[model samples]
Target: MSINQIQDEIIDEFSLFSDWMEKYEYIIDLGKHLPLIDEQYKDEEHLIKGCQSRVWLHAGLEGDKVVFTADSDAVITKGIIALLVRVLSNQPAEEVAQSELYFIDKIGLKEHLSPTRSNGLVSMVKQMKLYGLALHAKS
Candidate 1:
């Protein structure tokens, strides 16, 4: 789905819940949707820095696109990471490089997140996008 469609879906889901607690529950559910990675890929090379939780992200160039796989030890944080990957994964490097992350503002994510979590999320997104940019340059 397009990122706009993903944003619309997330807004709809969050709107159904009356408070942050339920919204958080939805986010956790989103994490559950992430695909499981191979046990071997769960290594330090894939690990994401800056997050309080242990997050592992792996990306590779597939044809002209970049595909990502990620996981996190914390459920809610995993969900947040999954949300980022959902909108960014499996897209062309150019699209990933040019894209603006609109979901963060639409979900009011930064406001609800702790300062550390917010910074970590930014780092995660930047890392994934940078991987795409580097792959684009190589190809």
Candidate 2:
């Protein structure tokens, strides 16, 4: 599905919960379902900065699309990245770089997160876009 479509789906899921606590629980559940990142990609180079917790993200081009793989030491961070990967992974590099990811604000994620986690979320988005830019350049 397109990134916007995927994001809409996420928003729909988040809307199901009337409270932030329930939403957080759902996010944690999403984290549990995240595909494991390969051990080889867990090195320092893949680690995202600005995050209070350790979040490692790796992206590679497959044909004409970018594929993301990630993991985090914190469950909430893992869930955060899972949402990103769900929207951006397996998408064309240019599209991934350009995606606005409105679902974040739509779902009140940034407002609900602590300041540090919000910064981490920004860093993760920046990193993903950077990877997209690099892959787009190569393509």
Point to the candidate with the largest lDDT: 2
Off by over 4 Å in 2: 112-119
Q: How many clashing pairs in candidate 1?
A: 0
What are the per-residue Cα lDDT tens digits for candidate 1 across 1-139?
7666776787676667888788788888877776646678889888766546677778888898788888877777778877777777778887788778766676767653455554356666778888988999998
lDDT of each: 0.74, 0.83
Q: Candidate 2, after superposition: displacement of residue 28 in Å?
A: 0.8
Candidate 1 runs further than 4 Å off: 111-115
Q: lDDT of model 2 at residue 116? A: 50
TM agreement with the true structure for every prediction:
0.83, 0.90
Writing each residue's lDDT as its tens digit, candidate 2 over 21-84 gives 9989988987888775998988888877554677788898999999999988778778878888
- Number of the top-ranking candidate, with TM-score as the measure: 2
Cα-lDDT of candidate 1: 0.74
Pairs with steric clashes in candidate 1: none
